[model samples]
Target chain A: MTALINLVYLISVSLFIVGLQRLSSPKTASSGNLIAGLGMGLGVLIALFAPMESGDDNYLIIIGALVLGSGIGLVVAVKVLMTKMPEMVSLFNGLGGACALLISIAELLNFHDSGTFGLAPYLTTLLALLIGSIAFTGSLVAYGKLSGNIKDSWKLPMANMINIILLLTLIAASIYQLQALDTMDLVYFIMILSLVYGITFVLNVGGADMPVIISILNALTGVSAALAGIIYDNMIMLMGGILVGSSGAILTILMCQAMNRSLLNVLAGGFGGGVSSAVQVGDQTVKEVNIMDASIILRYSTNVVFVPGYGMAVAQAQKICKELEDMLEELEVNVRYAIHPVAGRMPGHMNVLLAEADVDYSKLLDLEDANKFLNDTDLTIVVGANDVVNPSALDDPGSPIYGMPILEILKGKHVIVLKRGMSSGYSGIENPLFFHEKTSMLFGDAKKSLNSLLDELKTIV
Target chain B: MHLIIEILTDHLTILFALIMAIFLGFELISKVPTVLHTPLMSGSNAISGVVIIGAIILVRSSGSEDYISLFLGILAILLGTINVVGGHAVTNRMLQMFRKK
Candidate 1:
């Protein structure tokens, strides 16, 4: 029976690897997801059907909880919209953490009952408890911030200083607890500290940095789950946990590089708070163009590049934008999309958004590649995007987003920005690009402006 | 002395397993493109692989007299089920959208 179970574990691990590999491309992604799902389903079945000494009504309880939990998860997963995707991801990640936490606690209770407490298992349980609880609370806070249930930023004066002190105390107390070997009180204290740290760690950060926060928290949960696996001596858990942890860490590094920010800077968390109200535009004037006029410029353009951000997703304008792209191609306008690594609400969000519009994957150029074509492009349309293209990230040292690499779309000859108002973007930093001489603002709703642009282009030809 | 030695060796073995897992973990996900990060997040959540297995083993090992572990075990099962079932379903739904036209 144990060997059969291990065989099932091996199959599940291979499926997970294949699923992750196939997820890299558009064509094989769905089948990969199906394969991974099958593996997980088989794993659960083996666990459920394994013949064991059934206690009175134990199987019933297990089945009941399983059904109830899964029912809730499935309903929410299906019902959540694309705009709410980040929050949902964070929500599910938290649940995974809670699972690991509960399992570790269960182990601790059983070990105590059996009078078998070893140093290694005990320390691992404590570690799992600590990481798991933090992941739970941290993910919840991330969900709240993404969904606007919690304040993205609070005026916690010296928050960084306070966080450092709290971290030190947590470490000191953990060491003391480990030395004394008095179990319950110390475990509870560490759990509480972890939960509190999770809250403050996210609270000090504003909403703009949510994707990074969520990714790192997911990695923390992975590490915790791996620890739980260690306690249980479960090979599947250890392997899965490591995969999730490493993937998250690697993605975090890539995203930080894309933003030109350090992982340490991101964790420190005071940068995304609010735009300073005292800033000036330094004598640059704003330009406005009508839909017909904008269409004429785009129609005659030799090369056009589209840069999208979260606002495009919120406006659900990707389809219409794709329609415009098709029309431009009909006009023999060389068009391509420039995607910032951290463009949308989450990493890779813009890709999904554009992919949903049935945009060809080959046409989407990453940041560096897009910049290569930017200098020669005739018209650059900023569609409901602000921060990713904001020249302040490049030019102004005083700006909070300074040194963050951005699409140098100002290199284009003519630029039109479609936005609802003169609001600062997700980072709440003022965009000097909006005031640039080469840029023109077509201020309105993204979908509305996009429809207008497409209509005018079609009629002109 | 025998029991102490056994426990210490067990600890060492688990530690070795952990370091190896971490090393193997970093190697695999480095090549995943930026475009797939969203699906990757949702897909890997389904990878909460151990929760179900661990919960099952915990419950099976719990003597009928241990109600506390039984309760915790049930809770673990519930949470693990939600993560696995929900995570996979959502990931499939997202990946379906990525299919070629």
Candidate 2:
């Protein structure tokens, strides 16, 4: 029976691997998610048949929990808007972390009752507890930030100092527990401290940096689950956890690379605090373009590129933006979207938003491809994006976002920026592009602005 | 010292499994396109829900009188199910948008 279960575990692991492999591309991603879900279902069902010493029939509790959880999950999954994807992901990540943390705690209790003190089991349990606790609270904080429940202005003084001290204390306590094989009191103490650390660690990070924090927390949750797998000697758990852990790590690296910032730099907090008054916009006069003028410019253009940012998601302007794109296409103007990797709240946020608006995937160009297309484009329409297209990132070393990669939209023949007002971007950095020679500011709500522009284009065409 | 050595020897195969799984994870995910990053993340987030199995195992072995472990196990199972069900559902929903367009 054990051998048969192990064989099924092996097959389920293969399904997970194959599912992830299929998720790498656009065409198979949906089915890939289904395949992975199938693996999870099989693994959960087969776990019922696994050998256990206790004869207590707890199947009722298990089935009830599963049904209740599935009911809640299905409702939220169906009801959540695409704009809330990051928050939903963060919430689910937190649940996974909490699940792992609880499992480790339960196992530890069982081990204590059985008098099974050993270096291996205790070490894995401690690791899982620590990582799982952190991931849980950290993820919830991230969700709060993303959902606007936690304001960016909320800060704890000496945040970095506090984090370092808490971490050091956690390490010290963990060492003592391992050395002394301490009682449950010490374990509970460690868990509380870990949870506190999680909250403090993420509380100070500015809103713009939530993506990196989410990715890190996701990775931490995966690592904790993997540790739980080690404790239980379960191959499927081990494989799935490692896979998620690595994916999150890779994503963290990619996000950092997109912004040209290091992981440590992000974790240090204080990013996107507000505009750095030190770097002024100087004497460059701001250029303003009316809807009529902007429409005429776009209508006559041979090649036009749209740059989207988080504001597009906030104002729900993606559909209008897509409508503008279709209008331009009817005029025989070449239209494409330039998607900066870190453009929105999360990785690939703009792509998903645009895709939801029914924009063809092929019309979206990544950072590299978009830059190549921007070089010779007739005009660039920036919809609710600022920082990603800022020229200071390339030229002014004094700027806070100096070294980050930008769209270089100035390379095009003309530029039109649609925004709500003359404000700094999410990072609170002033954009020189707003005052540049070739740029024209079209100030309004992004969706309203796009709607007007679309109307004006109708008159022209 | 002898007990420590015994534990290490017993877990040697599991350790190897860990190392291989880590490598396989990195290799499989390294080539994913940026556009799919969101779905990939949510999908893999669901996979981490496999910890549900451990919760089940723990619950099954705990006696009914052991209220602490039973409560913890049930809660773990609940949260794990949410992660699995919601994560996959959300990822599929997002991917459906990408596929339809």
The C-alpha TM-scores of every prediction are 0.91, 0.97
Worst 10 residues of 1 chain A by lDDT: A270-279
Largest lDDT belongs to which candidate?
A: 2
**Model 2 per-residue lDDT tens digits across residues A328-381:** 898999999999888777778888899899999899999899999998899998
Off by over 4 Å in 1: A25-27, A49-57, A270-283, A396-399, B1-8, B63-65
**What's the lDDT for residue A151 in model 1?**
67
Please list the residue runs of candidate 2 whose C-alpha ends up more than 4 Å from where it truly belongs after superposition: A270-279, B1-7
Candidate 2 chain A has its poorest 10 consecutive residues by lDDT at A270-279
Interface RMSD in angstroms for candidate 2: 1.3
| DockQ of candidate 2 (2 decimals) | 0.77
RMSD of each: 3.1, 1.8
For candidate 1, what is the lDDT? 0.78
